[model samples]
Target: MSHGYPKEGFNLVGSWDDWKSFVPLSRSGQSGSFVARVPIRRPPGLEEFQILQGQDWAARYYPTARGEGVEGPGNAHGRNFRVTPLPSDCMQLEILWDVLGRKVTWKFLNAAEQEIQAGEKKVAAKKGAKARSAPRNQASNRGPFFLVGSWDNWKGFAEFLPFGDSFRTKVKVGLDMKRVEFQVVVARDWNRRFHPTSSGDGLAGPDVGHGLNWRAEVGGKKWLEVTWSPDRAPYVEWTFPDPADAHEAAAEDFAAMLRDLAKEGSGAWFRGMAGIFEALPKCQRSSPYGAKAENEATARCLLATFLRDLETMADPRGPAPGGQRGALKELEEQCEQLLKDTVGEIDYATAGGDFMQEALPVDPATGPVQLKLWHRLVYLPLVMYVRNTVHLYEMLERLKAQSSGAGRGRLRALLDAKGTARESPYSWLVFSIVGALQILYHARAAAEKRGGCDAFPLELLASSPPQTVWIQDGVEWSPSHGSGAGAFQRKQVVNCEPMKPLGTLRKGDGLMYRGIWLPADADEDTIRYQYSFQSFSRSIEGVMRVLRFYSGVASTKAGEAARAGHILMYIGVKFQGWRLAMASWQ
Candidate 1:
């Protein structure tokens, strides 16, 4: 039927047994005209049948004015067109429905013309039919089924290749055809066939009505492979592994792990714990010694609460025992309370002493021993707290990336709020703990130094070497003296070269001028500079080699001076605004 509604199409419906279902009319080759040829069988003594314009009774058509041979008065609800049984066995009735005018017209063709059209249809069907061969692997007792579709010109069925657990076939669809429709039939038996859903797209379940065909739109590529899996419901899927299905499966597995952890501790709990560790940033897990006791406990509690809420909210049975909105809020309240309780229990005075005794059993009778014990206790947990906070930050970031939908809105919001590197509560906690530990370490070190025994040598506290070092070329003269007035005074001409700008540096490397330490500006540089005096033996030997070349100094005396750790002082020369300096041994 032609419809003025323009947006939606309508189907034909009637009271006859054969017309109970909707039959769509063709609009091809006609302007605003919907045409259909309905074949009706009249049983003996059958008087009349009713025909309507739409699938629903509400949309049924009614006559606006009475016409010749038309029966019945129309009403607001609906009106049925009257049908008269012809004397022949069956008749082909042609109908034209105009939706805009709310009118329908129909007429029966002469018996002679109907017979001629029926004969022509049969001839065309015979010409289009072609016998298709069965697959080589087909069972002898069972006949072969084949795939038939518009893509193949409706000529005949094509055989499918037998493969492990499935049947497959490749077909080429024409680029010009915007869409193609097809079905699978068993040994030319239409009744035993696979059809698409009513919309002629997607795989149809067994519960779907019959006679519909599957359809696919043409892609840029011409070649397509189709597969059928008897074991799988709907029996068909396109392309390769479905990305939506894969993503859904991963989400399900994550949810299942959370559920297991919430319900009880078992193998599933261990697996879930592994997932927590896996979610941590790689850098956090790199340390040989793992997390501190208190931080680890906090992390476990946070994870447990977070997972419990996620599982409860996502439960299929609906949020009941644990309401969606309250679950996370309750957990957050509990965590805040726990933080308060734990912080109250910290006794700073006894905490440091207790930690020192627990970390190291050695008696702090000596200054050095007390200092050693304090350093261990303070540094160990400081490292661990930093790592745990980092792990927690990374876990939150991962959850934020994966979260979606209204159900997870609160969680996403919380993650976004706490995701900052600078003001996050976890970061603040780590910073406060580390600062406290450093204060404790320094206080204990100062106390030990006040005692009679030497705590640690201050002379050992020299800056580390610069990463990149260069040897000097030009020789400069310098005066050197040590241990006595005017003793072994000499004018030393040492090699010098301009220092290169700093880049990436490694251990055992430094900037040098005439084989001596050249300190880069310490005020502006973040990297500590190492003095050559720290490696006394090597520095003296290097200077001695230069002295031997310039002066006739005895090898024995130079070796003695190197072993004694006494080196001649070098002076700086302002060359091209760069600090060029060197050391010499007397």
Candidate 2:
């Protein structure tokens, strides 16, 4: 078993020497010590050992350190010296020690210049000057060999590992095996050219005799994602530090752009939100998870709607630059703020102290059928989606900023054309269609180059809270009495719950945050109900009764100002509609 060991179980044509041979005499078989060694000698010309002994290779294994979260002892290492066998079959080994057994091992191609020198005992003579002489090359990616799994579309595998740079996951302790580990490799660029394979690809390998686990520390605390494995895969995909930090970074970018918009006085931001509202009902849809898709859809639609309105006000109608645009600008700023707060919440969840593992929900009908497929098909994709939106919004804001000073008159022609032309609501359909075409276009090239399709736009799905709503619950109604008039389309489940906006409540602001959930065989007259706060009075948190209003939570009698207030009270006897809906949901 050389440095480039092919997981456990596969036999190497080496000396009968077990781990004890290379281990220091005083530290052999002992766990959690710098001096102790686990021996798996690499035989020259042996393919298995050859991989580990590439140019230079050395490794150390230790039990999962205490408070290393759920996973167990892991190993990290790098190449030091190339060890070559002598006439008596004695192999020369080069060992470079590092912190907490995290280091690189070297097995150079050179034979023992003299007799095989024995490794000196460092742990035994605690605090020895020579032992302390080892320099801490913190830059080395080598560590006790651990594995982690990540669902990478490019690699088609979560735990794919390559030689030069390695995110090769180390195993976790006290648990079964999984795969995928991200340890520091000697070369930073090694990750790009590695041999990547996905779980569905049937890329099976070894199970560690012990678990492998480590935490990427930040600000003195492990991340909120406590990744662990329960099987031989030895892989768990985790964003070290925190997933929120990443999200906030994206949000900050988006918010900064909004500030630019505020300064530019571009009505585009406001009109975009107005467009979102206008387009929402038309494209309202649901997923099988019971998520109405309304909330996320509303966000999109409102955003688009507001943009349209702002542009309209800027040109075709109202004053060129007055209170009209100002009001819309304020709304635009609010949306930006909403998005920012969402990122903050995202950070909060990942940082929450939840030790239990969660079963990621998946659409069995159209999901990846492999280990942690939900992540590739869903989680990471959503992260990318949120991030992309942030980027796009920023771009939009910046563009508006640059165009602001031109005066509404310059953009008048463009605005007039839009007002009269066919306005297509921005929806995932366009993105999906385009993405599919791109996938097809890349298929041939990908096949030839062995690279996965990187241009697929499968990010239409939002990675919001996995909410569940069903046809039994009935959909919300619009101001007009009508079924099928949902925030999104119907005929499936919806995933979402009452999103309690963490501030004071307002009339017509938004119903208890729930998405749409349509049932199969649903069509033009099917009704779906949702619960809402019955503001009998303006007191927030008032003991609102449950009610089950019909589809299209809209009433013509409660038109105009009602759109801003009494969104729930006018639907039906407040507290009454919710009761019926809750019973059905139950």
CA lDDT, candidate 2, residue 144: 19
In model 1, state the lDDT of residue 203: 40
Query: What is candidate 2's lDDT per residue for 21-80, written digit by digit as tens?
Result: 122212123242122111222223221111121122233232234423212122223211
Residue 369 miss distance in model 2 (angstroms): 56
TM-score quality measure for candidate 2: 0.19
> Model 1, range 1-586, lDDT digits (tens) per residue?
2235433454555433333345456563555667555444333312223334344544445543353333222233434455554423223455676544445666554322233222221100101111121122221111133567787676655544332234444455665788876666544445445555454334432222355766666665454446654332225444322224434543564444344333442233223333333333322222111111123323333332223323333344432222323433333343334434433223334322233223222212211123222222233333333333444333332332221210222222222222221112232222233444444445436535675223322211122111121112222211110012221212222213211222211122433333322222112111122211112222445555554422221111222234344344443333124464544343
Model 2: residues >4 Å from true position, as ranges?
1-221, 224-239, 242-251, 263-266, 281-283, 286-478, 481-586
Worst 10 residues of 2 by lDDT: 123-132
Lowest-sum lDDT 10-residue window in model 1:
122-131
- Cα error, residue 184 of model 2, in Å, equals 20
| CA RMSD (A), model 2 | 28.6
